[model samples]
Target: MKKDDNAFGVEEAADSPGFLLWQVTSLWQREIRKALEKYDLTHSQFVLLASTMWLMQQGEPVTQILLSAHSKIDPMTTSTVLRTLQTKGLLERKEHTTDTRAKTVALTTTGEKLARQAIKTVEQFDTDFFQALGSKLGDFNKKLRLLLQQ
Candidate 1:
């Protein structure tokens, strides 16, 4: 175990920001998985559903491309998940009124109800998960936003 055998730039693994981010993301996702379990929703499902709900609330016509963009999910995966949701009767996809080539997405009554409930559950989970950051959470979020902008 010679020190020269490794290519790490940091003296300690914990000193690497990317490694720390990966650790935190994994832990956070695990908790989110548990929180969403009661609703029988996968993380991707919850994210797409919630994003659709939000866009609808904003009076935006939710199309598959828009949903994919809003959720930061790849278009193909988004389409597949949406198809599963449609089969489960949680949402519906119809030909867009104005765009013949696109499909619009909307939550059914049941889906809307479920989304509201799941949002509350997830939000509570987030509050608990990030509680350790306390007053620094806002700054942390701003940093994340800055990273996203890049």
Candidate 2:
């Protein structure tokens, strides 16, 4: 270990894949944050609401656990965000029909409307952001999926 070398052995932060990923992710998140600002929602809140609405459309009785799993968000965080959404009049948590201890969630009328509007804004932003990839977005996405698999 030379005195000037990073303890983790990367010659430079710029050469580290993890560091580069973090940088890209942070910049992308900033863009998303800007787009979501008009809706008065945080990224996590938007993700949970959007995921719940999508899952509910596929079937009935969407539970918090189901939403968390579907959104790839942690259960604890999902619970907290759902409560906030409920308070905001966007959703409600009710006792599960089948599970005694679990709770089911559904979007309120206002919640569904906001979710739809937010989806449009988010989709537009995503299209413009990824347009830089031109014809290679499929390959880029495939590589991202491969990384997730690993």
Candidate 3:
């Protein structure tokens, strides 16, 4: 493949697919952060919470390790976030009945309530953010999935 080297001393950004992707992703994340500020949750926290809730619906006992895998979050960070969630009464951690080495995590009543609220907030943000794209949303998602696979 040919490279574009023009004005920038560094390799031209136009020639670098990763650089373009990073630029667009940074802009998207900035907007997402602004939309999430009112909920007092960071983007990663929201992802972990949403992932936990989704996996819980399957009725299997979910451990911190499982949550970390599902959310693609680092184990140490997952533990810290879970502790924070527990302190907020949004989740509970107790020794697993079958696995002494692991603990089960479940959403408390308050936690479930907050999850629902946060879900609504996120849904609204997504709907509004994608409104302009309309039918192109499917194509965008498809292209993103393809890029992710690469």
Q: List the residue pairs that clash in candidate 1.
A: none
> Model 3: how far is 128 from its true place, Å?
2.0
Q: Which has the greatest lDDT?
A: 1
Where is the poorest 10-residue window by lDDT in model 3? 1-10
The deviation in Å at residue 61 for candidate 1 is 0.9
lDDT string, candidate 3, 2-53, tens digits = 3444555446666567787798788778988987787677888778778788
Ranking by lDDT: 1, 2, 3
Better of 1 and 2 by TM-score: 1
Worst 10 residues of 2 by lDDT: 1-10
The CA-based lDDT of model 1 is what?
0.94
The lDDT values for all models are: 0.94, 0.92, 0.83
lDDT by residue for model 1 (54-95), tens: 999999789999999888899999999999989988999999
Top of the candidates by TM-score: 1
User: Which lDDT tens digits does candidate 2 get at residues 1-150?
Assistant: 674576766778887898999998999999999999999999999999899899889987899899988888899999999999999999999998878999999999999999999999999999999999999999999999899786
**Which ten-residue region of model 1 has the weakest summed lDDT?**
1-10
The model with the greater lDDT, 1 or 3, is 1
